[model samples]
Target chain A: MTPKISQFLSQKNPSTPCLVVDIDEVELRYRAMQAALPAARIYYAVKANPARPLLDRLVFLGSCFDAASWEEVDLCLSAGARPENISFGNTVKKVSAIKAAYDAGVRLFVFDCVEELEKLARFAPGSRVYCRLLVNNHGAEWPLSRKFGTTPESARTLMLRARELGLDPYGISFHVGSQQLSADAYEVAIAQAGSLLADLAADGLRLRMVNLGGGFPIQYRDDVPGIAHFGQVISRAMKIHFGETLPEILVEPGRFIVGSAGVVSTEVVLVSQRGRDEGPRWVYLDIGRFGGLAETEGEAIRYMIRTARDGEEVSSVALAGPTCDGADILYEKSCYTLPVTLEAGDRVEILATGAYVSTYCSTRFNGFAPLAEHYI
Target chain B: MTPKISQFLSQKNPSTPCLVVDIDEVELRYRAMQAALPAARIYYAVKANPARPLLDRLVFLGSCFDAASWEEVDLCLSAGARPENISFGNTVKKVSAIKAAYDAGVRLFVFDCVEELEKLARFAPGSRVYCRLLVNNHGAEWPLSRKFGTTPESARTLMLRARELGLDPYGISFHVGSQQLSADAYEVAIAQAGSLLADLAADGLRLRMVNLGGGFPIQYRDDVPGIAHFGQVISRAMKIHFGETLPEILVEPGRFIVGSAGVVSTEVVLVSQRGRDEGPRWVYLDIGRFGGLAETEGEAIRYMIRTARDGEEVSSVALAGPTCDGADILYEKSCYTLPVTLEAGDRVEILATGAYVSTYCSTRFNGFAPLAEHYI
Candidate 1:
């Protein structure tokens, strides 16, 4: 077990299938990121584990928020974050949400298409807007394919359109992808953004900001470079591409800020074999794909699981969530090995589940409650 | 569009991205199942769609409930279902849930392991327990692997253990599979269960019940045999396998009875393209995997999608949800054709989404509300 989880379990015996967020670790990660990228303003993405305690702690530590919707804006505001510190980051947003954000004194918003620009012009008039530029997200663990962002030409057009509609097209943004592993991806995306900014400057549109959208990866089962490494790479890329005219930089980091801070303590409901005695043992947990571990879909994001019975003989077991639905199986092909003595009621802590858990949990599936969350 | 959806739209203009459940169709399906399966008692699985309105309707129509947890048992009881008419169907259950169910006067329960039998004995002593038998689910649309059920040898051991532990080992149960397409699957499973019953009888243990667990398929994209066909096949299989000593029959149908009865009306959030003009158009919906269309995970179960602009020019588009998460994508490889003119705010009704949609909805992800249920 990770020292964080071990320490947490020692403090409190939370009920099974509960998410424990260590606020101390979250503050540590936030400070680390802030220290690493001193030039860039960090807008903590709120969509990732939008638990009140985490938000409140971040706010108390002078953190900005990257809100995806009006509801998130309200959450951040309720958590005591200044509206000026919250950016409406989602490009595709409802007109009503845009209006609500505007009413709540949020001025910074993002847009990719003309319709979105039009919506912002109507609802959030005179607000600062960022155009998302589409980039190749080849090596990212969670590659976003043509969901957000626009082409350089489209970005230019949208910016010009924003100016025409009396909206401030203040910056250009690009997401390398979620859990992006390659620093070169950021280098390429930054270079592209720099070129676009220079081009817009040539056209007499003086854009002042560059939003490096979140994708900074955290250690799950794989080794990743520290926040300093990402900061150094991004700083070098911006300097090399933009020359002396380095635009004001903004960073949105979701998973990196909170991923390692949360530990999910789930209980083993059943550990049984299928077909024959020699077949793979299936370990059923109280939580599954629907219960907040939706990231385990397709086994794309493998969480490091540690059984409470540490050091006993280990055997590979196919892990599943306790749901009547067959699709609730978490890991079948990519199985986890638990201690051989592990059985019903044994607790297993799934480390690095802080981000994208609480916010992603389904209300009630198969009568299983959404993952209960506890904070330390 | 399906006739049901068209009729629904014609009557009321509900907000986009809402689930419209045809309670009339639910009643019709229930009556049809009752007419077809005269020997079997139908226990509607509440997990399929635990909307209070549907539960109340089912209860008013004299339907039994197959509850998976205490919450579901409470939902059934609140909907006016008698405690005696509800069965705790989930094999891997929490001890507290078991105790609560027992306290609520639930006597019928299902178990597949010795540990679960012990849990039952401690919490629900003397209650009638059914041991689930493992069977091949090769051709099932939603194949349950080692998550549920046990081998014949294991079932025999568990049943014997149940008796020793002071629990009534009253029946044998087997789920062929959810959305099982073949009638032969039932024949084979029933034969296996019959052999197990005979073996138990030879040991002087008289099992009094046989549970043909849910997995009956419904018409989506492909044509399926009606409820009558499944009923006839099940009846024949029981007669052929059990011979003269047919035990009391019980059926748990989740998807079949409710799948076709509900239609999900989702709006096109955005209709845009990828890298080039030649790339396939991506249609973003108000709902996605997290929004309650979770069955679309791995593209396992396909729901029939129809845009309001039916009979118009058609174009294949990659569908996605409005969430910022890339994994919220519904279909990309298996693209669906919509009216070429379909744009933002255009309504598209997803057929047969009633069963799993509402129950699986996340509370708030990306600030999108759970799919709102509207019953007619």
Candidate 2:
């Protein structure tokens, strides 16, 4: 356990199945990222954990925001972020949402297709727009599919079309992928961005900004490089490609900023053997995939878990959420070992779950309330 | 397209990404179940779409309810269901929820362990309790894991303990599985329950009820036996095992009551080709895994999909959700073929989605609203 978690648990006793975010850890992460990549502006992605408190804290720290829609832009603005500092990062958006964001004073937007570019030109004319370039995301733990970006050839046409349609062809952007593990992924993506920049420059279009989309990995169960290493790798790539004439560099880091700053405390509802006397024991918790941890879909992402009865004799158990639905089972194939003495009411803490939890929680399922959240 | 969906679309134009429940279909299904299983009591499971309109309609039809939580009990009561007609079906429940249900005059409750029985003994003394027996769910389309219920030995002990603890050990219940396909599954489960019932009878305890828990399959993308066939199979099993003396038979049907009654209308957000030029076409929709179709997790349950341009030239396409998350991709391996000319803003109707779609919807993810529900 990290000292931050130990300190928070020592001071506070929250209700079971509650998410407790350590604000101090958020501050530490933000400062570390800032120190590592001083030349890059950080636009905190609000979708990770859009709790008002975290947004307010980030705003107080003078952090820019990467808003996905009009609602997110409103969330940031309500948290006191300057509208100019918020970028509409989603490439596929409804025309009404585009108008809503433009009306709310959001000037920077992202687009990947001619349809989106046309929507932008009509809804938010003369707004600064960035074209997203398609890149390989094989190494990312959460490998993003070909969902958001366009090919290099298609991006060129879109950028040129943006200028013709009375929208500023601001720059280019690419997401390595969420929970990207290696700095080499950034090197490859940065090199791709560099080539796109050169190609666009050859067409006599001088782009003013480049968005290195959110994908910075955080330490969970696996080892990951620190923010400084990512910064060094990114800085080296930019220098080799763009030299000293680098455009205004912006980085969106959602997980790295808040992933480690939060911890979820849940209680064991039941621990029972299913089949025969010697069959595997199933441990049920008040929280599950629908409760807040939707990322556990297919058990792709594993959160580092700790029990109050740690250091005791342990056995592997299948973990499940407290719901009548059979699909609520959390970790069945990828089972976790808990203290043999663990029983009902025993607490378990899931670490580094601040991001993608609360936002993904359903309103109510099987009479269980949504996961409550607390910030320290 | 199903005639129900076609008529709905032809008569009324609901907004995109909306759930349209045909109340007429619900009435037909309810009446069919009543005609098929006249000897068994039907308790509509409220967890599967607890929309007030449906509850009120079910109440008008003199339907009993199988409530999962206190909130569901309240919904049933508000829908004009008598307290005695409601059964607290979920085995895993919070103590507070149990107390709330008891206070609301709910008498019947289900449990599978000593812990839950004790909770009932404290909160709902003298209340009738049913013990759930473990059963195999091997061939179910949505096969339930070992999430609920206990072994026969444990259940026997629990029932006796319930009698000793001032709680009424009323009956036994078992769920074959959700979307249970085979009649043989029910036959085997009924045999297990009958043996347990006979053993408990030999112990001088008279149990008065047997809950054949809900798993009646509905037609979606494949053929399933009607409610009459399930009733025949169950009746045959009961006659073979229990002979003349039979307990009060009760069935809790959630999906069967509402599954075929609803259709979801969604707009195609984008249709683009990914990877190589010959690769599969990717079709994105306004709704996705988080948007309410969570049962599609692992593509276990396939909803019948139809487009407005259904008769046009068809080609296979990979379907996805509108969310920015990579895991939002809906069907890749089990791909759907749609009109080759399908484009953004075209409508698609997902049939037989009325049961598990609305209540499971999250409030917002990526700033997209939860699925809008409409009853016709």
Candidate 3:
């Protein structure tokens, strides 16, 4: 725990668990992504902690929206995002939810099967649809093929059926899984989507868009590629597939939007012996699995936990939550040393996990406190 | 997916990620526990769901309250529980929370260290303190030796300090851990608490209560011991040590009380082939890791998932969550099969997990719907 962190919380507000978003960082990243892909469409996946202020800012920056549920759709609409720009992309949606989206004028719906397509057609025929195709493993770092995606053998058949039903099948989309490390997988998925569209050309269907789904690695971990390098690969794949005239590129990047700009600020509750042995003591922090820090498998997302004010250092201590459960630990082990006198009530901030944090947290385990989101 | 399940959901409500409490089953279990442990005092741990209706029933049944936070304290007080009957038993508590409990006339608080005790004294001076002792390995199936609790030497020192500070320390408590399969762990923990209290007596501190904390197991899994069988071992230990008279036996039962009675009803959206060359097929359910079905170290909590209306024949199928992530599988290989002929839009109820289900769920992964809770 950092001494400056305690002083900072005392100075502002003494809330236990709160998400602090660096607005400048988010703006910079969004601007960078916009600059790189000028013609490509960017849909901000709002499932990643849909703070209203963040949403309002994203809309102000002229970004389109990709909503998963009617609630997210409502949130975007309330924030003044155009309904036509909002694409409802979850695989399994309730009938009422489908009707609600259609009634709200959301035209682009992602479909993986004939069942979903039929359901959409019955509820909202003439709506624009995107047929999601499942790309086979072309040596990707994790076989995320288990998730929702129509396989190659069935994609052509599904597209033909959509055409027969008089629904405007606007595009094809496939993600190489989130946190994808290799450019090869993206290239293969794009090639696969292009080949499927080409195969369906005998039906006289003109593919207006091809979405090589966003798994462009952000290099949070050691082995993932940088965004700029991955951009070059995407550009190359688009040129190779479309023969000098590419369709519009649509990418949904949830983590890449605000994941690195957010930190869960917490306070130290206790520092005690981890065991009876003469080993390192564990420093219990206010945040736990309850605070969305549990996303990492038994390890906390790396954040610079130190004095929030003067940046005074503190000794390395094992971070533990207040929950009685043993698995409620935040960090596997302490990595950094501190300089200040840290004790009970000292504050610590967990970093780089803004996406899919707090708003997607389980606030009911052993009474862990929720973080107050402060946009920087 | 069971055939009967699909029929029910298509006919009835088909919502994704909803929790339902079997009130009849809960009442039966509550009565059975009350009958078995007539001599002991029972306190329902509010950390588990804390349903208002359930708490009301427990209050009417006359169980003392166990509160872990100010929110729980507020809930109990609002539910008309006398502050005297409620024990604020969390080891690490905020100063404001302690002060709030003190203002509410809460008298007893549990402390795990000298620092916590000191914090309690500063806020709620002259209140009786219960020092939590570290239970040595008593062979509990899942020993909770870590997190809270001090060593014997440190506990003794803390007790001596409490006396010096002109404060009264009344008791010792030790939780063996949750879901204990072996009864021997309770004996060992009680013996351990007794030995420490005996040593404290030698130091001239009069200890009134010895809370051999609750870890009585429930049969979520087959191998876990039955409540009655585990109760025998606990009662026998109390008789052997205290000899027909003992400090109030406060057993904190959350999962044992409401776990079996609670069920989550989810809609089966898609039935997909798991792997080629015959791996198996999966019925993707609406709930995921964020829903109370989060697996502990990749093993989901054991539950009997079945259809509500029909006694249809069952078949094996893996239940996957709606999240795009591969880790969101509820159960990779379900032990028991549900009724057959389950297809898209079927409802499956996962039983015996009411305790932690709704309190720890998120509906926004991959833009999924929010978790809705209903208590009957």
Candidate 4:
């Protein structure tokens, strides 16, 4: 947790099962990315944590936004972001949502297949449209399926179609995947994009931008390669692949910007070992899978946890949320260890939960309220 | 879809991505379970789509409730249910919640460990508490972990401890699992609980109840053992184990009571095959895993889907939700087939989605609102 969040939790002691986001930390991460990639325009992914405070900070920093929906476009606009500064980033979108975003003056949008391209052509007429290309998800913790993106061969045809349909064939975009572990993942995608760009140029289609979609990783339970390593790797890859005649660089970083800026503070509701003589103790917290820690699905994203008794005796434990549903478990096979003396009412803080958490909570599953939020 | 729900949808033409629940059908299922298990008490598990209208209708039919949280307890009471008719069924609960339930005159609760039993003894003093036993989740689509129950040996000790600590050692409880398919699953669990009850009696503690916690099946994409089949198997098992001196029989049916009573009405957002010549079509809907079809995680609860063009030629398709997140996919490998003519603006109905769909929705995962609810 950031010092700002630590001080807020210590002083305010907001109710358990709430998130505390350090807004200053968000601005700091934004500047760090800006400084690292000086030429690249950083589009803060609004879907990560679309809180007004976070958006307001980014808006003040003149940060561009990558909105996933019409609602998110409105959120960015409400925070004083310019319409031209936001890109409708989700590949699969409703025609109605496309119309809404267009009517709201948003021009840039992303599409993968011909159907979505057709929707944008008809509803978001004459808009800047980019085709998303499918690439390898080699080292992502939350790897995306073929649910999105088209083949580079298909993307070439689709971008050509976008131009034919009275749309600006703006650029190309592709996601390496969320929480991407390898910088080489982006390298591979960039190479694919470069080859496609070179082929498109021969067909008299010169795209102006290369939208490097968000997949930036942050510190969790394990030590991840810092952002500097990713910046250096991306810069070198761009130089190697697209040399002198460089296109506009656009990077969407969601987790890297806001992930470490927040923490989830929960109370231990119950702890059990199920009467076993030899097994990990089951630790139950007020917040769980349905409660907001959804990235823990399949034990994919492990978050570092802290307690008031952290320096005390410890034992191996399985962690779960407080719900009646069996699927509400957060981490089981991950082998998380906690203080043996941990009991009901003890405060516990899950670190680096700032992004993709507050909004993922169920409205009121099992009659429990959604996780409350505090932006310091 | 039920005739009532189908009629409601055709007449109402509500907004897309909404759940239409037939309250009359809910009453019918409640009464059907009551008729099948005449000697058993039907406690409607409130976690499964606890819309106020659903709860109000069940209350009017004189149905008792199995609440997963203190807020659910209040929901039951607000719906005209008597305090005595509500049982705090979730084993993992907060001490403050226990005190609140006790102060509200709730007398029955469930616990699986010593720490929880002590909390009950202190906060809910003299309340009737049952020990939840861990049973094999064989033949269950959504199998539970060792998260909410104790072994029979541990249960016996906890029950004795309950008696010694000014609390009523009410009985033993075990959940076979959600969407349980095999009739023999209940038989094995009943046998386990029967032996435990016998052991507790040998300690001079006369337990007064046996909660065969709800696992009654409802039809989905695949056929399951009907509620009648589950009721008969449970009745026969209880008879073979306890004979004539049967304790109070309690069954908490959440999904079975409401699963088939609701249908999710959604609109097709986009369809893509990723420019592949031969592959399953990728059909994206207005709702998905985070949009309330969370049971689709691991593709467990497969709900039968119907489209307006159902009679048209069909093609194998992968279903997904309209979100920016990659994990928002509903069914990719489950081999769902849809009308080849299905396109954007086409209405689709996800059947047997009444139980766990509405409340499982993320509040606003990617700027998309939670699944709207329409109870008739």
Candidate 5:
């Protein structure tokens, strides 16, 4: 946890299993992104912990937004972001949602296939629409589903179809994936997008934008390359590919700007060494997968655990949430060790939990209330 | 969909992505369970789907409840269940919750370890408590995590400790796991419980109850042994193991009583044959994993989806929810087929969603509302 979050937690000592976010830490991360890629406009992805205070701070920093739903678009607008600064980022959309977003003055949109582009042309007529290209999710920890993005062969046709249907074939977008660690992943995708751009340029279409769809990694338990490193790599890659014709660059980051700024305070509900026969102590917390740690699905994004018993004698332990479901087990195979003295009622701080924690909480599954949130 | 739910959906034309439950169907399943396990007291596990109306109907059917939390116990009580009819079933629980349940006149509880038993003794003194035994998950589709239950040896110690700590060492309980397909699973667990019961009896502690915890399966796609088979197998096993000392048998059935009683109606948000190069059609629904189909994690508990275009030239398809997260893909590897003519806005009925669907929905992961629930 950041000092701001740690101090707020100590001072407030809010309810257990609640999220604490340092608003200033959010601004600092936003400024870091601005310094990393000054030319690429940062459109903060709203789906990752869209607490109003965080959005308000991002808006104050003049950050644009990439919203997956009209309700998220409403959240951004309510946070004082202009509609012109918001991008309707999801490809699969309800036509009603498309119309709702269009009527709300959000002109920029994203689509991957002909049906979605047609829906955009019909509902958000004359809007600037971009096609999402199917990129490989090689290095992302929380990689996006292949359900997104059409193949480039399909995207080429969809973009032309968008223009014929009276929508502007604005650009091309590709996500290297979420929580992407390797800078080479972005470089390879940029090369694919550049080839697609050349293919479209030969077809007499001059797309004016290139959305480097969000996949910026945030540190969890492992060391990762800094944002400046990614920024430099992307800058060099774009120049080498596009030559002098640099289109408007936009990067949508959800986890990076806010992930390190938050901490989840959960109380140990039960600690037992006698549960498992093979013998790793099972520690149950007030929060689990259903309680908002959805990213822990597959034991992928392991959060750095800080306990009051840290620096004491430690032993390997299995972790779980306080729900009845079998899937609520947090860490079993990953070999997590906690202090031997840790027991019930002790607070455990899950770090780098700012993004994708609160909103992912189940609505009272097993009768536990939704994970609470606190913005400092 | 059942005749009632289908009629309700056709006549009412409710909004897309809603669960329509036929209340009578629930009662029918309850009656079937009553007939199947005539010797066992039925405790409806409320964690599966704790909607008030369902609980109210189950209460009207004279069903007891096995609640995971005090809030669930409260939900049961608010729906007309007597406090004595509720069991605080979760092994891991907060001391405050124990106090609340005990104060509410709840006298029965389950625990797996010394710490939890100690908490019950302090907060819910003199309560009838059972020790949860960790049984191997052999034939269960949704297996309970090793996080729950205790080693039979640990349970033996905990039961003895319970008697010493001013709590009743009432019985032993074990879950064969959720969606258990084989009747032999219960037989194995019963033999284990019986041996433990014998060990405790040698110590002169006369335990008078044995809980055959919930895992009753309902048909999804593949046919499995019905609840009657499970009932018959359990009855034979109990008689053989206990010989004339058959304890007060209790069976907790969550999914079996309610799984087939409900169907989720979602709209086909987008259908793209153009997206995937490998060529299974991509069907996007208004709802996905975060929208309460969380049982779809790891493609376990695959709900049989019925579409309007079924029986009209089927082809295999990849399915996903409308969220921007990559993990939201529902079934890419599973060979699920749909009509080639299926398109956007078509209603798709996901079957067997009655038990675990609505309550598992994320509060609003991507600005999408919780899956709407309607009981007919």
Candidate 6:
């Protein structure tokens, strides 16, 4: 446990619960992804735990930033990301956020629905925009295909409206749902996106970019494809669908970029027996659903967890938080043996929580503050 | 809508999201429970959203404070609860916390494990200690039995140990579970607690109090029993099982006291249609699982949502939040007919979130700040 956690702890003060970033691992992945897709631009989703150190590293790797809110826009700006390189893709933007992002130099934004497009038309004149297509290509059944993305018909209308308003509609973007495990989903989404772009071009609309919205699968489970392979498949599909003339490609790889770069270190507060005979015992930890790990609810995502001291392996024990609520249990059920009994004051290291975890969760229950983040 | 929200919002800053508390609702429940258990004392669990206004209201209702941590103890003390009226009952006491609570003038505490008792004995001598009994009297299905409550056999040993250390072992307590829906569970737990108290008394240990523990169910779901009837059941069990000759009885009610009195108000950001032909449509709100309402997960609890404004009623639509993650959907599949089209900038009130909502949670994700709180 200690060996696994040594890199995460402050050599001076190791006991404090916090989020540690594996900068080396992050840089290695960044370099690999960059090497694989040298022509494609990578927009680091700033919503995935925007610590300054991580932002700095992404900048060093030539990765742009994807911001959701004005605050995120300001964060990327502070991290020295050029506004021209940042994409404000929250879709549902407040007028103030729109102005702020534009003023902060963000050139590209996403237009999902007509209302959002109208808002953009009224507030952001002459801004480069990406009309999001609902790639209902029967991709991953995930994300339920029902939020921001407008239908291809609606996307056509939005693109025409953008042209009518003299807005620079530079490209089309579509998310095939997050944590999408199917490789065919990308192939189908890319085909749909390619068709939409061709239709818009046929309708006299020119495009210079196509944002294949990021849903590149991260290995939360071994059954999922590896990130490198996912990149290769997507690149190949883009070439196959649109050929060599495909617009300058952009991938908003949020989870794949930072998901494996961070680990949350929490203490085991209590361990209790569950089923006396046939059931597995449970060990209550200091983290739960609110511990920046909302992706597990149905994302088909799982995290690597281990003891934080002495390099011990923990056995299969259900984990729950201190919340009296039953749903506070973290894992469904799994088994592993630890080097030692996780007594009071023992810490557990949860891996791959860097991405959608803390960035999308809150400490709105049990009074546990969000873990302080540190980049290695 | 503005008119309805006016009662729970700041007149100067009306648009900010917030949790609103109705003091009267909390007070009425506290009084109803108090009147039913004439012989039983009341310790309001402050960990269940210890809002200052709520604590002040509970104090006005003549309820003692039950603090689970040093932060809660400090909150109670600062709220003007007399030191003698505060009981520090967290079983796993940090050494510093034990010394701190004792120094803060809290004389009553619950000791569950012998190790904790010994630590408290070494640090806080002559304190009025309560032995927490591991009464697995909850329904057979509730498998989290080994967490708290020292068993009767071990509790007796702990009581003797405390007495040997010159600590006043004045009471016995048992926690059934949180939001316990079963009236029989409380009755059985009380009966078992009575037997334990009687046995301790027979062993020449005088009992000054008996805590029936907090499992007082709140009406989160349609099938949950109302607090008024549940209070009567618990009051009757204590009176019948302990014969009214019991020590100054105590019951800690966390969820029941404030669950109905509070609601989280957030604005609608977007609405999206999910699935096709036969799928559900979702209205995206600004709140989610990490947004102080734990109702989004598998927790049996449900939030009764309504439009903040009174006007035309619209069709029921599924609700989600601003997070890009799939788990950000608020309603699993529940439909809510609102007073208006929940467009951007419209507020929706998520009711029954007062208990174990904000205090147990913090706004740490996505760099979102916790909603400001208000008291009505």
Give DockQ: model 1: 0.56
Which stretches of model 4 miss by more than 4 angstroms? none
Task: Report clashes for each candidate as comma-separated counts.
Answer: 0, 0, 19, 0, 2, 33
lDDT of 3 at A122: 86
Who is ahead in TM-score, 3 or 6? Answer: 3
lDDT of 5 by residue, B1-376 (tens): 7899989999999998999888899999999999999989999999888988899999999999999999999999999999999999999899889999999999999998888888999999999999988898889999994668878778887888888898889999999999999999999999999999999999888799999998988999889898889889999999999998689999899999889999999999998876555779889999999998988888988889898777799998999999998889889887999998999989999998898888889999999988888998
Q: How well is candidate 6 docked (DockQ)?
A: 0.29
**lDDT tens digits by residue: candidate 3, B1-376:** 2244334445656455677665556677777777767666677788876778887877777777788888788888888888888888888787778899999999888887777888887888888888887776454444566667887778788877877766678888888876666778888777777777778878888687877666666656466767777678777887776666566667777777887776678777766552233544567777767666764335535566666535776656666776656556666655555555677677667766677666666534555545776666
* Ranked by DockQ, top first: 4, 5, 1, 2, 3, 6
Q: Clashing pairs in model 4? A: none
Cα interface RMSD of each candidate = 2.0, 2.3, 3.5, 1.0, 1.2, 4.5
TM-score for chain B of each model, two decimals: 0.96, 0.97, 0.88, 0.99, 0.98, 0.88
Superposed by TM-score, candidate 5 places the C-alpha of residue A351 at a distance from the truth, in angstroms, of 0.9
Worst 10 residues of 2 chain A by lDDT: A271-280
Model 3, A280-338: lDDT tens digits are: 45777776766566555445234455454335655556667776666677664636454
- lDDT winner, 2 or 3: 2
* lDDT digits (tens) for residues B47-97 of candidate 4: 997899999998888889999999999999988999999999999999888
Ranking by lDDT: 4, 5, 1, 2, 3, 6
lDDT of 1 by residue, A47-147 (tens): 98788889999999998999987889999999999999999998777777888999999999998888778888988999999998999998788887557
Indicate the TM-score of model 4: 0.99
Docking class of 6: acceptable
Error of 2 at A238 (Å): 2.6
Residue A93 CA displacement from its true place in model 4, Å: 1.3
lDDT (Cα, tens digit) per residue for candidate 5, span A80-127: 999999999998899999988888899999998888888898999999
What are the TM-scores, per candidate, against the unseen true structure? 0.94, 0.92, 0.87, 0.99, 0.98, 0.85
